[model samples]
Target: MSLRQTVAKYFTNHAETRERHDDPALVSHYYKTTKDKAMAKLEEMFSDQQLYDLNAISKEHGEISVYTKKGRKVFIIVTVIMVRPFQTAIDFSVTSESALPFDFGHSNKIIQQLYAQIDQHFTPLDRN
Candidate 1:
């Protein structure tokens, strides 16, 4: 494995990171969707995986307090906002539940996968 992978494997216990994306097409869709509806959609997206302690903080923010299936507990916060007409931004904050200093890149992977899934399902607007 590479040096980065080695350190991630040996020295990390938890990880945290954030991602931001702008989706012009999703503004109206998100505005029309309720927080409960969004949370349900997220739950459905991860239905095949294990999740727990999921909560929607508001129409614009949601949190997942625990994810146990991955061996380490993970906490995730998702925020959605409308920046302008037909423009929406989504942000995600993910943190691992371990006491150790390293997270083995787990949190990064989670955010990547989430963005991939959301992009695939929702289809962002083309930049051109």
Candidate 2:
């Protein structure tokens, strides 16, 4: 198998967004779904490679200035993990963030945006 597959099989999908805060069922479902997708991606990328070194590359914190109709505060955190590849000699970033909104709607958007950016950045490295 591959390292990515190994990670996917064990990855957690649950997301803790502000929108699902009130509903336990919805929150649980969100978490599982995200976890499953994330794990699948990891398994695809890292299953076979030896863990040469797995370490935190960097963590950046900043605010995204997206002015919506309702002013919502967003706490933007970006995490990067660097891995040493035994097979191809590559490095990549696995980024994630907590999109919590003081209100309700924007959190979902933030999470989706964050995931999309990470996916776009990482998908190519895994393919090669």
Candidate 3:
């Protein structure tokens, strides 16, 4: 990633955890599971009505949209993809609802928190 890209990520209100991200921790995490199971788990997790409120989910497209229950009022979208028979990848896109031009990496932190929760529930695969 370029210097501008790295700098922008910290200042922007939006951050996305994707494949080959500049920060390895922000990269899309691979899990040992089928896409169906991944999606189901995500749905069940968010439906608990704790930190997040489930907005919409598209199992066919492997996408889930949600909002934080409090603090910064973030909008987050999680995407789950099946890369192989039993290997799946999960990604997060987060945006903070704020009037400020920047969020001071709060969005990135939200992604990290989401990843941590996922790690608790899923068997993570080594990134290759």
What lDDT would candidate 3 get against the real structure? 0.89
Query: TM-score of each candidate?
Result: 0.57, 0.28, 0.92
Model 1 misplaced regions, further than 4 Å: 1-40, 43-49, 60-70, 126-128
Question: Which wins on TM-score, candidate 1 or candidate 3?
Answer: 3
Model 2, span 8-67: residue lDDT tens: 423432223332234231121111123233434434333333431222212121111111
Please give the distance, in angstroms, between residue 125's alpha carbon in candidate 3 and its true position after superposition.
0.6
Residue 105 displacement (Å), model 2:
4.5
Instruction: Let me know the TM-score candidate 1 reaches against the reference structure.
Output: 0.57
Give the TM-score (vs. native) of candidate 3. 0.92
Residue-wise lDDT of candidate 1 within 6-119, one digit each (tens)? 565446553333232232211222333444555556666665555545544454355434354556677776665544554544556666777777676676676667767776
lDDT per model vs. reference: 0.54, 0.30, 0.89
Worst 10 residues of 2 by lDDT: 59-68
Residue 21 displacement in candidate 3 (angstroms) = 1.3
Ranking by TM-score: 3, 1, 2
- What are the clashing pairs of model 3? none
Query: Which one wins by lDDT: 2 or 3?
Result: 3
Candidate 3 per-residue C-alpha lDDT over 5-113 given as tens digits, one digit per residue, 9 for 90 to 100: 7798778898888788787668889999999999999999899857889999999999999998877889999999999999999999888988898898898888888
Better of 1 and 2 by TM-score: 1
